[model samples]
Target chain A: MTYCVGLLLDAGIVLLSDTRTNAGLDNIATYRKMFLFEEPGERAIGIMTAGSLSITQTTMARLTDAIEEGDSPKSIMHAPTMLQVAEIVGGMLSDVTSEVSAKMERMSQNATASMIVAGQRNGGPMRMFLIYPEGNFIEATADTPFLQIGEHKYGKPILDRVIAPGTSLADAEKAVLLSMDSTLRSNLSVGMPLDFAVIEANSLEISRRRRIEADDEGFSRMSAAWSEALRNAFQQIDPI
Target chain B: MTYCVGLLLDAGIVLLSDTRTNAGLDNIATYRKMFLFEEPGERAIGIMTAGSLSITQTTMARLTDAIEEGDSPKSIMHAPTMLQVAEIVGGMLSDVTSEVSAKMERMSQNATASMIVAGQRNGGPMRMFLIYPEGNFIEATADTPFLQIGEHKYGKPILDRVIAPGTSLADAEKAVLLSMDSTLRSNLSVGMPLDFAVIEANSLEISRRRRIEADDEGFSRMSAAWSEALRNAFQQIDPI
Candidate 1:
């Protein structure tokens, strides 16, 4: 299980993801689910993945390999536009999923994954997309400016209420974290430390990147505060 | 998609269910999902359904028929204990599900449904059981005094945060309504009007019952208040 959320706001893009992965209740492990691709001023892309670890890891490795090959059409760094970059990632993800699912077919196991791709290139707009396992994707628009993957429902109400295109980079970060906080409380599978990143609009660079550990004081304080505030809010509603 | 939740508290039990039913987005209708049985002063049982409507309807019908037949062992009203009442409901639900699935098997359609059974008999302890389609069930305990079925995740966080065995009946009512409010906001399949019922512990009868319509002023007020309070709560947390 995993929980990853990405927001494409006017100020920037915000992405957050948990690190826990498990094959079963007893086979739990922590694995980084967020990948950052940066060429400093040239381009910066953040990819947060959910679903099969094998498929996502392989997809990430292939994307990195394509980038290291230098100026290849398949490399996201050299892609002409953010749309093209999404196409490349979606294509690679679909291929990896098909291959993995084929191999696991005999065991009746499913191998599929999806990703949130958000970034900007030198003169392009800050854009974000949710890439599905079938290689298809959807872009975030002003009306719906956020995308979430894995263990999403428990945390969705807050995002549904608070997020919009004009929301500030600071508030967007808070919304995603509080959203993640709700998920963490209800679901044992989505664990910490968390990987968080923000890309300022038009910057073509990752402005802020953070890894929030379970014991991190700031994250703890915010989570506790959110819980207390929620209880207070709940109490404020009149009983029918 | 549907949403129904039941809680067993020291004060009694709280049960709530939405009235929406749909075959698909285009094919939607209103259908009651909560049924109450009370030989008032003797026992009070509330059965909330989710999943296949055909199966649930049949199960409820059979239970009603058995009760009307007067003192049959299969009749929940005649069952010696609340556990036996659960068994009767579970067995009927499981049988209906199997029969319906057999009829739908050629089209590869599933016909399973689940239920939350909560109430108390004249001499029995207040109890609530979640009955699965397989005719097996699990009772709620002090550690986890709630049961939910159908599109449950969106509504779960509030219940997890606020509900406990010692919670007062009024608070329990508020918790379930707010929980349903979250689900209604996130899921189009769970709609209004809602059916709510409460039974006081050791009373052997329902204490309160209400039908909350879409225009129900008090419910609308609470829903609006909850959204506003949540936004305020979200703003109160410090940004990282």
Candidate 2:
């Protein structure tokens, strides 16, 4: 299981993902699930994956290969708009998922994955999308400005209450981290060493990319603060 | 989809269940999911269910029939202890689940249900059991004093943070309600009205039972207050 979230706020886009991946309880491993593509000042795209690692890794490899082949119609870096970038990524993800699932069929195992794709193209509006295994995707809108994939439920209430289109990028980052905190505490499959990135709208550049380790002081302090605040808030509610 | 939670605390037991049942997005109806059986002043048992309607309804009907039989050894009212009561309920639930699943097998449909049983018998300690569809059950312990069924994940983080064996019954009630409030906000399938019940330790009788309609003023107020408090809490958390 994994937990990755992307928020599309008026100020920018915030993305966070856990690094833990496991085939089973005994075969746990840490793998980076966040990928960034940038032609600074031209286009910046962030992709966060959750689900079968094989499929996501293969998809990423193919996307990287396309970018290296420069001018390939499939390369997301050269795509005209954020929408086309999503389409290119989704297409590759769908193809990879089908091939993997076919190979796993004999073993009766599923090999599908989903992704949160968010970024901006010069002169284009900031956009975020949730891509399904079938290659289709849905964009976040003004009313619903966030997308989450994998082990999402335990951490969703806070997002539902705290996020909105006008939320500042800083607050957006806090919301996603706190959401991840709730998930990390409730589930074992989602572990530490988080990849976080902030993309200031219209800049077409990745502003901040940080890897938060298990012992990171700032994160620990923030998580502790959120938990204590929640307890205090809970205590303040009038009993029925 | 449904949401039912049972908490065992030093002061007593608190149980809450949503009243929604659906075959699909377009087919939904209201159905009570909480049941109480008491030989007043002797033993009090509260059962909350989630999953296949056929299986759960049939299990409830059979248990009710056994109770109506008065002297039947299979009757929960005649059970020797709270553990025995859980066994009787689990056995009936497992049998009904199997029968219903077998019947639905022709269409490749699966039928299974789960339950949370909480109560205290005269001279016995307060206990809560989560009965699985396989006739196996696990008791809530001092360290983990809550059992939940149905759409439980969305509401679980709060319980994990605040619930303990020593939590007061009043606080436990607020915790479960706030937990349910989280689920209600996140899931459309888990709806109102709700069924709530409380059993005080050693009382051997349900001290309070209330049906919370969607328009209930106090519940509405509590939900609003909770949302406000949560937002305030979110704002107070130091940004990372």
Candidate 3:
């Protein structure tokens, strides 16, 4: 299980993801799920994946291979728009999933993966999309400016209440973190050493990126504050 | 689909369930998921069900028939302890589920249901059990004094944060209502009007019962207040 959220706000795009991956309870391991592609000032694309690690890692490798073979039309860095980049990634993800799942079918194993692709190119608007395992995708709009994948239910109420297209970059960051915090409390499969990134629209660069460890003071303080605030709010409600 | 919660608190027991049933988005209807049985001063039992309505309704009918026959060993009303009552209900539920599922298998339909049975009889302590479709059940203990069935994740975080064996009946009621409120907001399959009941320890009778409709003013006010409180709490948290 995993939890990843991406927000498309007026100020910028915010993306966050947990690092835990497990085949089973005893086979737990930490693996980075966020990949950043940038030609600073030209383009910056962030991809956060959830589901089968095999499919996602292979898809990432193929995308990286395309970028390494400079001038390839399929490379995310060369895509004309954010939508095109999502299309290319979705195509690659679908191919990889089909290939892997075909082989795993003999053993009755699943090899599906879903991804959130968000980024911007020079002169283009920042856009976010949730790409399904079948290679189809949906872009976020003003009415629904945020997208989440994996263990999403526990973290969705807050986002539904607080997020909007005009929300500030600062507030968007807080919302995703709190959203992640709720998931962390409710699910054991989603664990820390989280990858967080912020991309200011039109800048074509990641403005802020951090790897929050288990002992990170800022995350700890924010989590403690949120818990305290919730308890206080719960206490304040009129009892039946 | 349905969402039902049962809490075993030191002061008493709290049970709440939504009444929505749907085969699909177009086939939505209201059907009660809660059934109360009491011989005031002798015993008080509440059963809240989720999953296949056919299985649950049939199970309920059989239990009722046993009680009506007077002194049947499998009758919930004649069970010696709350645990025994859970066993009787679980056995009936499993038998009904198996019978229905075997027939439905030809049509590729599901016929499984789960239930939460909570109550106490004279000389017995308060007990709450989550009975599975297989006729097996698990009782709630002090460490985890709450049990939820169907669409549970959306309403679970708050319970994890606030519920305990020592939580007052007033607070327990509030917790379960707020929990139901969260599920209602997140899931379309779980809707109003809802069934709520409270049973005080040693009373052997339902202390309170209410049918909260969509137009209920007190419930509406509480829902609005909760949403406002959550938004305020989200705003108070420091930005990452």
| Model 1 C-alpha lDDT per residue in residues A187-232, reported as the tens digit of each score | 9999999999999988888899999999999999998888799889
Q: How many residue pairs clash in each candidate?
A: 0, 0, 0
* Tens digits of per-residue lDDT for model 3, B1-240: 899999999999999999999987999999999999999999999999999988988999998999999899988999999999999999999899889989999999777999999999999899999999999999999998999999999999899889989999988888899999999999999999999999998899998999999898888888898999998998898875
TM-score of the A-chain for all models: 0.98, 0.98, 0.98
Q: How high is the DockQ of candidate 3?
A: 0.79
How far off is residue A137 in model 3, in Å? 0.7
Pull out the clashing pairs in model 2: none
Q: Which stretches of candidate 2 lie over 4 Å from their true place?
A: none
Q: For residues A1-240, write the lDDT of model 3, one tens digit per residue.
A: 999999999889999999999999999999999999888999999999999999999999999999999899989998999999999999999999999989999999777999999999998899999999999999999998999998999999888889998999888888889889999999999999999999998888988899999999999899999988988898889864
CA deviation > 4 Å runs, candidate 3: none
lDDT of 1 by residue, B74-118 (tens): 999999899999999999998998889888998987788999999
Model 2 Cα lDDT, one tens digit per residue, B4-122 = 99999889999999999999999999999999988888999999999989889999999999999998888988898999999999999988988888889989988899999999999
Off by over 4 Å in 1: none
